[model samples]
Target: MDWRTKLLNPKQKARQDYKSLVTPVYRGSTVVFDEQSLIKDDWKQSENGYSYGLYGTPTALELGARICDIEGAKHTFIVPGGQSAIALVYFAFCKSGSHALVPHSAYGPNKAMAEGLLRDLGIEVESYDPLIGKDIKKLIRKNTSLIWCESPGSVTMEIQDVPAIVKAAHEKGVPVALDNTYAAGVLFDAFKYGVDVSIQALTKYIGGHSDILLGSVSVRDDSVYNVIGSIYMQLGLAVSPDDCSLALRGLQTLAIRLEQLEKATFQIALKLSEIDIIENVYHPALTSCPGHEIWKRDFTGSASVFSFTFAKKISGDQVEKFINSLNIFKIGLSWGGVTSLAVVYPDLVRPNKDFEGRLVRLNIGLEATNDLINDLEIAISKIN
Candidate 1:
């Protein structure tokens, strides 16, 4: 063989038995089989064995498996990001002429997809109140195929009655999908509450450091798994194994991070509630949040993200001034990292109420509770 032939050889000369506490990043596009008869492409790699890297490399599968174990799902699929997970579920369950129900308070991008891509595809996704609960049955039509719930919903922080919604959907043979990112899959037992499909933006909590973009779709049973898996393969939603490796590392510290974040956030929320200028603090653990009792019943714990509203007398411009005044709490979006963040929704929309730009959402990080409170206090003083 020529020197070029030796350089291109696939054989491993070094000992391959190295073991480590961390998952190694597996990067490759092709999978080799000893026999041509064994060559095939399948997405059920967990059962059928690895046939192609497009399905997922071992590192991605391992992250999915760990999420499955924590969320108590039958199977889990890893995708590029949370929005991708939402897209996968939408494509899997809702087809042309199919009707679906989604909370108006769902992640912003989720609603955007419903109105944009899903609408253009001939699928109609109707928005419902996050507090609809068992009354959701009233909205189901003969063509209804899917229902979506997002507990402690994006920005507004409404904790939904998921079990009631699940029961209502199941009676009509419709499936329920949840955006379980806020709970980080572990805080809320999605499968236990009868949620058919539970999806998360691992970019937030499971990534823990906000450095990686990843998502997971976990199913309650094999029937749901097959439905999602088929679409997953067709869409070719490939993820970086390097991101998976980071998420795998994130899992190791998730419990401790959640513990600290919960404490710090709850403390800050309590302090905010006492301020006369703050009309509401929408943390799921507090009674000010819609469906607080449901959150206590369904979730094991509360997470870092929550929203608050300024007094009606305060204008949107003042809210922006307050946000800019903060020293430690950075102005940004997304949550569940080590850095605290604040953002104001000047144009937030719901069914009957108008925020008038007084609504602000905060993501509490692992910073000192007192320090965070002081940051908010100083900002509030500046605005006044």
Candidate 2:
């Protein structure tokens, strides 16, 4: 063979039996086959064997498998990011003329998709109060196909009564899906509560370091798996093998990270609640949160992200100043990373109330507890 032919050869010369404590990043677009008869393309790579990289390389599948093992799911699909995970569930469960119910406090992008893309597609998503647990049945319609619950919802931090909602939806033959990102899948048992579908933005807790963008959609059973899997394949939601590798590493430290984050976050939330200028602290473990009892009953533990509101005396501009005044807490969005962050939601609103820019959300990191508290104290002082 010519020198060019040797250079283009796909066969490996090095031994492939290398073993390590970590999963290696598998990157490739084509999966070569020895026989033409074996050539195929299938998304059920776990059962049917790897046929194409579009479905998932070994690295992506391994991450999905680990999430499934942790979450106790029948199957899990890895998508590009948390929003994609929500999109997958929405597309899978709702179609033209299909009606769905979502909490008013769901992730901002989730609500945007519902009002925008899903609405444009002829699907109607109605928003309901997050606290309307079993009474959710009252809102169910003949066309109601999907119900979404996000415990400790977005910036408002409402811990939903998931079991009650699940029970209600199940009785009416409707499926309940949860944005389980806040609980990081492990802290809360989605399947145990009768949730049909559980999705997470692995970009937050599972990624741990905020360096990767990934998400997972785990189903309670094979029946639900088939429903989500079919749409997952058609959407061509491919993820980077490198990002999967990062998330795989993130899983190793998740338990310890959650432990420290929970402790530090609760401490900070408690301190904030005592301040006269802070009207409320919306941590799930605290009484001030909307569904604290439900959280205690349903969750094994709380996570790092929570929200707080300034007193009426504190203007929206003052809230922004407080966030900017923080030295250690960076001004940013997203949560469950190694760095503490703070951001204000000036335009946040529910049915009867609006934050009026006094609402601020915080993501506590693994920083020293006292240091974080001091940072918040100093910022509050500056605003005062």
Candidate 3:
């Protein structure tokens, strides 16, 4: 049938003949060609054709192809990390004298990128409320080139109406790029939802071990892929072959890990709601979440990444005490690993003026739910 089917069902003879369980990490700067032939010229001349390791190797190609399948994209470009994927899309589409609409409740760095770097490049970045729905049409201008979105947005976790924004942007000949890292591609199909470009940071759930950092941009059409691919080539953005291998390996177990993590996190979120200390819990699965209706309509699953607001003021020392009291949840950066993590989100001040409270973002890992809950209860009781 198709390549995906073939990959899933390799013959026993093929398996017996193969020497490696994993794809051999193709390591080298330049790919060699036969002597005195046009093949070398093709390698150097064609954009999609391989010339050097940075352009792509077998290892990276395998990962990109797999991600493309999952994203329902015609083509894919692997980058250094999720943030770089976002940056690549911005640089590729946004030029000097252009304008872009960005959701107010975006990842802080994305907003910073638009304001600090894109502004310097003469690109005007305008922030619209994520809850604006179809009203986003009001913010679009004649010069608008891109509409940047993040569902279940950063710390505040506001999920936007993707279809409305996509329809509006496409009507105006603008492209929509979504940061789908939160839902991961398994739960939210970006292409199905009308996103022109979908970005994911493999550093989060894809590379579940947290041992590697990688990112990819999956384009809905060949034309858009060509545009992103051209910019990627021109900028020389690439991921290491080893990192690709790790991410690929992690992909095999992603579904199972996500199920366990979601189950654990949902239970923890329910318990958080019962605690008087927690003011608000921003998990998409929770009914109180701002965009739960949209989430219930569009998404198939949720991740362990959710935030809770505290009712009372607490010092950095008290925050540390709470974190330190946890026996299982480690204080660390990044998530989707086997072990649970808890972080005091002191820097998570929402740009949206309506959101105000001290917060902590928890990434419930593949741990016993009761033990994690008990640890949290003990730690939070100590918070003053």
Candidate 4:
């Protein structure tokens, strides 16, 4: 080797194979080819070859493979965040002059995307009742291209009829996209239920902590992959290898953590149901949740997130007192972390503001069940 070439600090001649229990972290924008003559563009085929960092790296691919294994999917794409994964699906399927029927209770940002970018691009975004099942057939348009479902719709917690909706959409030759984040792709089987594209916000459960942000797109068919993958490549969607590594670490303990989260969340939901301060507990496992029967039939289990409203009429000041009285259960947003959180939806997420009463959402975390229950009881006592 020439002295000048050997002087580079980043280049090294020492050889050592990396062997470990975790996936190796690869951070590189440019992949080195064996020889100048062997360079080609197929590297973006993450499943088949080493690709550009924007498409995926070894670290990203490992996480994608892990998600695919859990979801029983043919292919998976790692994206920046859950909302971006949703956007990627939208770009892949919907075209100019096409229309989509979304649940009225979809994640607010997704609804905003439909009304913002998709609408400006000539796609019509419409909202359907979350409880609509086979009846969704009546709303299918000749130009309909996509249908969206979020089981146990965002904050309100109205469980959707996924199977019935999927059947109807498939009959009309349209694709269904689901925000399976609440299920963490664990409670619900997206592909088995006939969903074409399943998106998960790894930030919530797969990350298992509030530390990193990540998302994934799991496809059931090769045809669907080609469509989405094309858009994915063109859009230049990429994620941090460091974040992917963190999620991979989270997977090692996912099963146990999910089990605990399910148990603790259900216990808290049950306790809240009996409390006089709460009128309706909107948990999928609870009978009061819309389409609970459907959830019982389809979902394997529930997650850590749910919502409720106050029973007795109370002023805004009383609600504030309730919030301030809590020792644990800090006021915050997002969920599925080791720390408990609570949020109040005074304006609600949607602009329509259809929901009434004092709507409060809780994300049960890894804490003693009795401690969480007591924290809630103390908070409610101030308002009650």
lDDT on C-alpha atoms for all candidate structures: 0.94, 0.94, 0.84, 0.89
| Residue-wise C-alpha lDDT for candidate 2, range 74-167, written one tens digit per residue | 9999999999999999999999999999999999999999999999999999999999998999999999999999998998989899999999
List runs of model 2 lying over 4 Å from the truth: 10-12
Tens digits of per-residue lDDT for model 1, 321-380: 999999999999888888999999989979998999999999998888888999999999
| Residue range 1-384, candidate 4, lDDT tens digits | 677767864465656675788788889888778888766576346656664688788899999999999999989899999999999999999999999999989999999999999999999989999888999999999999999999989998888889999999999999999999999997999999999999999999999889999999999888999999899988888899999999999999888998999999999999999987678899999999988998999999999999987765765567667777878898998998888899887777444554443778899999899999999998888776
What's model 2's lDDT at 71?
97
Backbone atom clashes (below 3 Å) for every candidate: 0, 1, 0, 1
Clashes of 1: 0
What are the models' TM-scores?
0.99, 0.98, 0.91, 0.95
Over the stretch 238-308, how does candidate 3's per-residue lDDT look in tens digits?
67999999998999998899899888899999999998867789899998798999999999999988888
Better of 2 and 4 by lDDT: 2
The better candidate by TM-score, 2 or 3, is 2
Span of ten consecutive residues with least summed lDDT in model 3: 38-47
- Comparing 1 with 4 on lDDT, the higher-scoring candidate is 1
